[model samples]
Target: MAKKRSGPSGKRGSYAKGVAKREEILTRALDVIAREGYRGASVKEIADAVGLSQAGLLHYFASKEELFTEVLRKRDEADLAFSGFEAVPASADVRDIREGYLSVIRHNAEVPGLVQLFAQLSVDAADPEHPAHRFFIDRGALLRSVFADALARRFAEGGVAPRVPPETLARIFQAVTDGLQLQWMLEPDLDMAATIDVLFELVFTHARAASDDPPDGRAVREGGAA
Candidate 1:
């Protein structure tokens, strides 16, 4: 006698299992990359850690580039969760945002391998045809938008006007962060968290000054009178 054929339920179960397995691969890959530098973390190592062969891992991801990109994507999700910035409330203080950003940097200082991967991928992703290109582009836009929204809200509510528009400030923040990461990679002793903290202080001070000075170059009095 022949064996029975499975129906739609079997297909669904298989699909669910495939998704779970892919997730497991990405999670394990993240750990591997974090522990081993980008150059050291080979596809075989990640596959081995996840109990999969190179071919098996490629079955889950289209290519090695896609796999590494997914790992970076997972890293971003983990960072957001760690910073708690995803759930920031309207009533939250602006300083909380600064702390969240600093915390992520501090965490990065501990994960040199992921940082290396990010740097390499970002530069390579500059090519339009690269697998990680879309990921980098989308990540930049999303991060800038989130930062801008938070800054705009805080500036309006706190009565402090920034020297630059919130959108521009957001770009500046992003650029400074990327630059600092590159610099830190070169100089392992660089205190990224401290540097960013000082940057936040400078930004806030300038914003406060901008808020205090009127358009006519007159300083606003204590009670808002020019």
Candidate 2:
């Protein structure tokens, strides 16, 4: 005899259950990785955390690498949502983006395990053979482009001539943020958000000063007239 076909409701129920199970697995995997770091967390441990056998977990994610990729993707989605940039606003400017970064840093501080996981994985992924190497590379490029675009827009709006190219500024911003994360991981008491704010202040102050200086090295008056 053939298996009986389920109705639309049955199909919907099955789909919903599958999605829930997938999210549950992702959540549990994040928690385990947070505590154990990517290299330290075993597939068996993750599966056990979610009450599944390793083989069963494999049914959802074929490999640990694939699972790690999904976790990183989910983490980005969550960060975007928390940053209030799930959908960019028409009025969003560089200051808005900077605030978003600060907000994310604050959020990460509350989840030290996740921070530790990210720091450890990022360093290990520097090896070309690592599973997350490509992910980090792509992520770095995307973030740099985003920061560059935001800075460029701000420059255009404020007529603040940038002493450095937008792309260069973006790289600087990314470097500072990543460096601060590593430092914060080592010294948990460090205020990452405040440190980032100081970096922004210095960068923007320099940009503003450059914009105010004439080509001949003379400082312009505040009233737009030299």
What is the number of residue pairs that collide in model 1? 0
State the lDDT of candidate 2 residue by residue for 105-143, as single tens digits. 898887776776677668878889876788888888888
Model 1 residue 191 lDDT score: 97
Best by TM-score: 1
Taking every candidate in turn, the Cα RMSD to the unseen true structure, in Å, is 6.9, 7.3
lDDT, candidate 1, 1-226, per-residue tens: 1125433457786787778788888988888888988899999999899887899889988888899999999999999999998888866655768888899999999999999999999999999988899999899888877777777777887787665677676777888898999999999999989988887787677667777765655543332112
- Assess candidate 1 and give its TM-score to the true structure: 0.87
